[model samples]
Target: MTAHIEQAPLVRRVFWRLAPTRLFADLISKSWMESVIPFVLFVGIFTYLYIANPAFGTIGNLQSISASFSEFAFPAIAVGLTLISGGIDLSVGAIFALVDFAVLFMIGVWGLPTWLAILLAIALGGVIGAINGFLIGFMKTRPVLTTLVALIIYRSIFNLITLNYSEELAVIYIEDPTWNFIATGRILGAPVSAATLVIFAVVAHVILRNTKLGWRVAAVGSSKKAARHAGINYPLVLFLTYCGAGMVTALGAIFYAARLGSVAGPTGQGLEIQALSAVVVGGISLAGGRGTVARAVLGAAIVFLIQNGLTNIGLPGYFTAGILGFVVILAVGADIRWEKNKGKAIEKTLVNPIVFSFASTPDTSPGSQSPLALNDRLKDAEGLAVGLIEGPEDVVVDRLGRIYTGERQGRIIRFSPPYFNEREVFARIGGRPLGLVFDKDENLIVCVAGMGLFQVDQQGKVEKLTDRTTRNWLSILDNSRLRMADDLDIAPDGKIYFSDATDRFDLHDWTYDSLEGRGNGRLCVYDPATKKTRTISHGLNFANGICLAHDGRSVFVAETWAARVRRYWLEGPKKGKLEVFLDNLAGVPDNINRASDGTYWMAFAGMRSPMYDISMRHPGVRLRMLKQLPRDEWLFPSMNHGCLVKFDESGRILESYWDKKAEKHPMLTSMREHKGYLYLGGLENNRIGRIQLPDADQNWTAHDSYWGKS
Candidate 1:
């Protein structure tokens, strides 16, 4: 057990070395990467200051920074909360000033106790905020406009009251020991307000991340219409969000008033602008939705540190504001660009190009003499259910000659034949159904991408079989469920084997899987008898097709991106062993189906190209090309030209068939022989193809070969 545990990480290391996307996918996936640049800048600034000034890294200076940060941190959190709720509160600074003046006036002018005055002042802030909330939420006023108007009105009212009582308030001297201690007390060598700010930030972060209220706020901010459709009460949420921001601003005002021992018009002047700049610089999107309280605090800290450091360095006060403004613009621009081009950025930074050399082949030359040469054999083939089907990627015929195929609309359709004239909706599987087969009871089992394994009963009702396999714990990305479950083939003892092709990319983006060349794919099995699914082997490169061997002792799997086929033993002495069946193929393989003569029919979904092969040798070139070029111009698999090949159980290529022009059938994904006719299907083609197999078995059916004749 110990030996096995130790080997797991080693296996993963080897897997990632062979397939490099594992190195950078997780780094780019998280929202936190946005914080990295600012954090680096913070570190660089701090290091420079500490080296240049001996007093900068001292405990006294650290304490000063912490104390100053507490003043802005709470207000920044207030603004961040409102921003995340898809609204703005520009009156926060006005609210802060009003609260400070109200508390001092009540205590000094009216002889009220400090505690009562503080409570009333805080309540007054909420009341004022509620007025703004009502205007915006209930009265349908725009948030920015309503708040801007509120700021002007509140500031005028504050000035009018303070100006009237200025003479009487100037002579009063109020002092409270408890207020002083609360304002300046120390905990663990840090200021009480600073410690309290940390506690509040942590609590706010938890509430935003782990609560229904936070989810609602995020939904509203992300898209108001979508949030309403999802049944969130937008007006109520907005109202409560503004009310909460008002409460936070009140707390900050109280702290500021106590620390300074005085209140003035300039007490909270320019605070709203500074806090807003901090929010954007800290990685909170001003456009709305995604942000955290931690982000708010980080932004506040950055702002506080930069301001303090500039002051210590004897820089002019105006330079501090100018630098912050520049920072905000740069941060916002960087964020917008990153959001717009993240996918291409990920491909460029993470996916490694496959370095490969395609040696000269006569088959690829002007005049090919190999038996696997391309010709017009497929052009002469006839189309079946031409207008009724679209993109029948895999086609299988039941005993009664009913053709079943998966379509683009996440449904499996059945065409009944003598001539396949009747088209019927079989089942709505709710996923892109790919590889398919039948169980012993004639239930059609399917592999649905983004979903899991499923089966369609005789009544045409679809049932979920198993969507989860044993998670590859060593995998860099989460692999708890089958992602791109592409193909499957059933074993005799009620076990179904399937291929999960690239957990990182979806079926529609299979080209990305090829571009990545990462061994992020796996093979899994579902046992009907046990009602369980498990991984058999993993770390395969784009596992696409699965075919159970004729003797029922092994299964053949095609690693499409790697151009290889592998065999995994299911029974006999070699049980649980895996070995390569075929390698260095002429094209990228897709699906493999059993043939009556004990051979196999494999489809080349795409042929190899010289340019693509050359480009694979330079990962940097591939990555830059992916980012710089349009989707249609990127170097990708030559999917326009493909062919079908017949091979024996020993992995020998028997013969190849092709459509040289590739007009009728550009990409064949799967092919199966039924009686004397070979049925073909393409992933993007609009029709099912049928061609005569002259010397093939006339009475062979996959159903009979597995379950015996009825």
Candidate 2:
């Protein structure tokens, strides 16, 4: 018996199967699931109705639904327009009833032509809207209170007119065939009024989306104070917006009057409530300035469909009203909550945090004999224009020997030489300017952070050279705009090669990019002859320093976080090929400049540390640190110590310089050899350092070395 039981357990087997519905649900949960909510709700409702009642999907029922939606669609549009302008109009229903009575009174009682009566009715709406506009816009009255008053006054006028002329309004019918046809005709299996609704909705959408008036209204709605500061004429925008909304409501009124062939005091009563409900349900924010007319129409359709479906299913009228009210409350509450927590939610989703353990620290072991082990010699250097500037990042000497450097205030300051005194402003280019170079025509080309590349002439006038580069198709982050443009060098062929360091973060939040340890940088080229900009190489790890070779066949670029130097060939047999020139560096390399004797000088903004190296190997750990820890407590690259190293064409380390004390110069970003003097600049130093280079070519100028006798 024991042997038989063991055999049964071995023979039995079970298999599990997964359904397609589960997979779809998981996919939707991971992506932009909120965007599909409305569509899903619509489909779910339609499916439920189709299964419950077979006739709900028939052609005739759909047509009837479309017809009813067309009548209320225009009023919904009017309410939506006001909502987008950050205001609410409570008198839309009153305006509709007034127009309906006027059109009927004109055509039936006054015997006026149908076309003229319609025009007058629309004009009356405009006139009433102008009154509301003047009081609320110019007098600064509250929109809700002003419109509520107008609603009462208009309704009272409508009631008085109907009571005084009840018999005439009841029996005064126009027998014209054209009027009758317009009111009751069908076109292509749809109501004739449906065409008007579609046409007007399209026109309104275009006006709001693509017109100056639309922009002004949006500005006012976004912030009244900001709109005034931007010179938007807020009162005028508000007045015109209200007038336009009134005209839209009048259009809907005309359609209703023509179709129904009669006017009652309450014909358009409670219509405003339904319109508001539709606008809110359609995802139009009640707080304003953020919805489209198409969304309004969609909301109106949903509301109408729900009502029609409920009635067809034998539900009571009160049930439909109560359900609509519940929906409005739920939608408004959801929208408010979404707006409040949107930033936190996005950060939580995008940020992945983990702990990083180092595979190995930097080569800081004793007796290793590294190049950055020199003592402090920068203290012996002279500080030029010491107290006149702040944070001189990159230094350049013009043909006239004026020291030009970018300041923290977005101004290029020029210090007249001889004694290095007489400081004056060169040009005002917005954003933090990082790299500086001169084109063939003596135009000062600068790579500005947050702003793109720019050119400044001799007359202190600035012009935008190029701000856009070719976009990478598969990039997870947007790389079309230069984020932190760090360094640039002009090639011999009049092409400007620049490195956009870390497109994912700006200059201030650059530590985040380092923590990411992903390739989020690119090398871009701007051609002067064709006036075009394109990206030549992408997927670089924080590409920073840039220098063109003396042979004009290759360019040297530094990857800051990766601690490597890469050579991109521009001509000869290796053209368009990229190869590593230096790897496993002791520090984070910054700006690279060509020496007078065909060598390159590289600056280390920060020497590599143990924890940072370990962090680089475990990206998941770095991500966790970024998400869980405060920025002040986060581990960062060691950017305090200053060092410089020189290399030849074959990537041989020739010599190294250091400022161990960092008393005069710290955080060395650039080191340029000009006339036997190594001029150094730092990202946050108050003064510029000039050190004597005894063995360098004393008469060689960078301008002459690159573009001779220009």
Q: Give me the candidate number with maximum lDDT.
A: 1
355-416 in candidate 1: lDDT tens per residue?
44334322544247665776677888788888888889899888887889999899999988
Q: What TM-score against the true fold does each predicted structure earn?
A: 0.77, 0.87
Note the residue pairs that clash in candidate 2. Answer: 353-623, 353-624, 354-621, 354-624, 355-621, 356-621, 358-614
**When superposed on Cα atoms, how far off is each prediction in RMSD?**
6.8, 8.1
lDDT of 2 by residue, 1-710 (tens): 00111111221211001223323433333423443555566677778888889898899877766666787988898888888888888899999998988998899999999988989989998888888887878888999999999999998999888899888889977887667766767787777678778877898788888999887787788888999999888888888878878888998888788877788867889988999998888878888877778778877877777777888899999998898888888879987997678556655544322222222333444345754456566768788888887888898887777888999899999898788866899999989988998777788899999999999998889999899898886754446888888889998879999999977778888777777565678899999889999999987888999999998889999998778899999999999998989876778899999898999999988887767766655544665787789997777777778788888998877767777677878779998888889888899888888999888888888899888855
Error of 2 at 67 (Å): 3.9
What is the TM-score (0 to 1) of candidate 1? 0.77
Q: What's the true lDDT of residue 196 in model 2?
A: 73
Model 1 shows how many backbone clashes? 0
Ten contiguous residues with the weakest lDDT in model 1: 1-10
